[model samples]
Target chain A: MVHLVIDGKGFQAEEGQNVLEVALENGIEIPHLCYHEQLSPYGGCRLCLVEITRGARTFLSTSCTYPCLEGLVVRTDTPDVLRARRLVLELLMPLAPEAPRLQALARQMGVTETRFASDEEVDDCIRCGLCIRACAELVGAEAITFSGRGERRKVEPPFGEEALNCIGCGACVFLCPTGCLHMEDQDGVRTLDKWKRTLSLKACASCGRRYLPFAQIEFARQKGEDPPAEGWFEFCPDCR
Target chain B: MGKQAIERIVEKYGSDHADVLEMLIDIQEKEHYLSRETLQYLSERLAVPLTRLYHMATFYEALSLKRRGRHQIHVCMGTACHVRGAARILEQLERCLSIKSGEVTPDLQFGLATVNCVGTCALGPVVSVDGEYHGHMSASKVERMLKRYSETEANGVAVCQK
Candidate 1:
């Protein structure tokens, strides 16, 4: 345990937790993104910046990445802290105008509208590095990596081809807070709600409900080929 | 295989929740589905509310409440699979089976469903027939696979034997 003074009130917190985590655990609200508990903190958004005073020196730092120390003095809701956070939100608005969470956060911070002109074109990723860190740190599959430099940077597999090593674990999909990365099945059937989709056999020409892979059938037809009869069976949905 | 053996096994375990799921899975594997008698026995032995047990069974993607066919065909729909014409394969299977994704035939020979990514993206379009992986597939290939399974059914043998 470590003793710390946050906004003139003394409190005890665990030794290793960062300032933002400790505050949140203690019910003190602080604005932040790109700081999910499941993933490593990138501190890229800079939204949870706070003013800290120890002895005579006072400095502004991101609360998400900073570790809690003994005898530390923290002030999260100061005027300078609010001003810096508001500016960070202002900068992010032009980049992602359509994001509802961002818009709501901006409104809460007392910003009526964005000061800068909206950049009409933008990709879904905010370049927060959550996916990259997860792949490297959690899943142990370095199949995906950030490519290019500066504004042209984006995540891609080797040689820009399909990721062969990807296990389809869907960890990256779940961890993405912005809902950018999307996944579907091999047959091109997509189900956002995992349990809703049903599995039934494709109908055979001969039998009414025999089991068959519909996507594979379509593929063979398009290529002007006939399916084999030995391994495959055709039936109707009911018969399958 | 006998009733006495099943009763002895059930008595030894006393039906913990996890054990209940495992037992249900084993029973389904042997009997093709959970029969009304089996469900009743499980409900009593496990001390689990019948309604709660039903809810859990239906909640998971892996479990099924209805009787299944002799063969199960699982199609992958992960992002990698979708981009490579997996949809076409599904359509072909639907046409061949004469049944939709979730329905079983009147004869109870096959069951089909679409699954989320199975972690084999290199084989963009992949299908699993009774847990066997078939990669780099097409619609025609799927039909051929089904034909083979039908032959096994005619022979009174399982198609997924390793």
Candidate 2:
């Protein structure tokens, strides 16, 4: 455990705990988009910028990737930090103009308008890599990934083709900060339109309602998972 | 010969996953570009994920995922080279090839690309063909250079020009 001061409030955190997690755990909100609990720390989104003074070195770093140290002084809303964070948000404002999450965060940070934002309808994906991380780490599907670089950098599956290995898991859609990735279940088929993957939904034997994709159950079984009872997966949670 | 590179790369760095980039580079050196089939074979032989390999293939400027021309042409577009009519040289080359700077002729005879600098800034407007470098280039010289490689077998590489 290590002692730290965030916004002048003292707190104790685990040695390897990143500053963003520590601050959020203590109810000190630091705006972020790319940070996920189950996935590894990826500071792709610069919204979590914070000023840290460790001993004598004072620098601006993304709190999500900056691990807290003993006697570390963190300032999340400093003029310098806000300036940098707001600048990142401003750059994203136009890239995803219709993203509610981005708009709400901009309003919270007092960034009403952007001089850089163009009136062009562009993709809502901010390219934060959360979906990619979730697919690889959590889902173990490795179905989605990032391709290209610089201006062309984007999260996509292999060759931007339909993902054959994807089990139609909606983890990526659920965790997406901007809601750019979408999935829908209709006609007993689950469609991940973003990945161009469609899977047949498993209808409950008892309730006769689609609850999960069959591929997901097969994937879980292949990973050495077993149902609680022999016929457990035959019914939905409510029916069980 | 192409399959041998992958076999050798896997034999050498089979256990070390950190050297996947090195393996890809070695294969690209021998194969010119990374095809989908080659990547699939590498993924299975090396046990590395295809997404990770695809990331590196698309990420690095040095690695190419598509088949290149029989001959590779690299033009220096550095600050010094640009001032010495490198842009004109590139434009002339494009006009002759009927393709962009980063494009290959549909005949697969020539692949034209621009390099930042080859550290030979004094010899500004430098163009590298295959592994050979020509210095102090102008728009007029592009045709003479293309004549040397244009007659080579479009399906094969290396007719050995001096």
Candidate 3:
């Protein structure tokens, strides 16, 4: 464990955690977005800025990326830190006005409205790169990637082709807090609700009972695959 | 097999660092990662020596000359992630996959790595499976995630179909 003083409050935190982790662990509220715990630290949004002082040398850095050090002094609610955070919010507002989290954070920071203007109209990407990095770094499909360059850059699958490698895992869908990426179960192959089904009664011996699309099961069986077990029902009410 | 390709790359940029990086990036993208053959061809054409090129490639994190598995799992260990149980999620992945960080599965289906951050702190405890982020993850969630991918792989469906 490492000891640090944050916002005039002394606290002890586990070693190797970043300042943001330490602050939050100790109940110090620091405003931020674009810093998902699961994704890598991008430092793109520039929110979560904090002031760290060590022997009078104070500087600002995104707490999400700043690793905690022994005896470090940190402040998240300081005026300077607040000023920097406000500027970052100002820049992000114009990019994603529809995002309630972003809007709420901006309002909390006293940025009731955005002064920044963007001539190029586009959807809510904010370009935080959570989806792109997630696809490339975590999934290994390299199915979807960032294409184009600079401001023109957008996440796209290869040749902008319909994502072939996309297993419909819904990782990207869940990770995208902004609801930018959406998925639909056209074949009625229900996997997203797998967790919910686990809590319900077991289905027929042939097919698990929670729910199964009849057409989909029949299609699978017609393809020479085994149908649901003896006790398993053929289809859910919707399919029937 | 083709001198024309080498000629095209060399003639266009003329042995500069930026040019070399760009050429390597193109080659890497084409082949998925830099191969020995591609590096040799570059070394011969650029006349900058293979050792120097290797050094430069190693210096940049973006470039990977080594063979990468089909899937790369980069768990974010950033501050926000750490507080939000990213470590537990990573541990779950490692346990379920039966591999340590940076190790590819014996079947060549997956590879695991940890990244400092990817800038989405709002979604703490994020897990990127094969470059797709799965946010707000728990140990159970990670297990289900791996099972889903493994099932897809078992089904012989190209894990990344596009």
DockQ of 1: 0.01
Model 2, residue A62: displacement in angstroms? 0.3
Q: Give a tens-digit lDDT track for model 1, residues B1-162.
A: 355555665665664566777776666676666655665567666665444345445544556667776788878888999988888888877777766787775568887788878899998799888788899988879777887778455433332231
Q: Is candidate 2 or candidate 3 better by DockQ?
A: 2
Best by DockQ: 2
State the lDDT of candidate 1 residue by residue for A63-110, as single tens digits: 889888888899998999999989888887776777777878888999
Of 1 and 3, the candidate ahead on TM-score is 3
In DockQ, how does model 3 score against the reference complex? 0.02
Chain B structural similarity (TM-score) per candidate: 0.81, 0.80, 0.73
Query: Which pairs clash in model 2?
Result: none
Q: Taking the tens digit of each residue's C-alpha lDDT, what string does model 3 give over A26-113?
A: 7888876666666677776688899988766999988988887788999888889888888888787777778777877877889887
Restricting to chain A, the TM-score for each candidate equals 0.71, 0.95, 0.72
> Which model is ahead, 1 or 3, in terms of DockQ?
3
Looking at candidate 2 chain B, the ten consecutive residues that score lowest on lDDT are: B153-162
State the displacement of the C-alpha of residue A180, model 1, in Å, after optimal TM-score superposition: 2.1
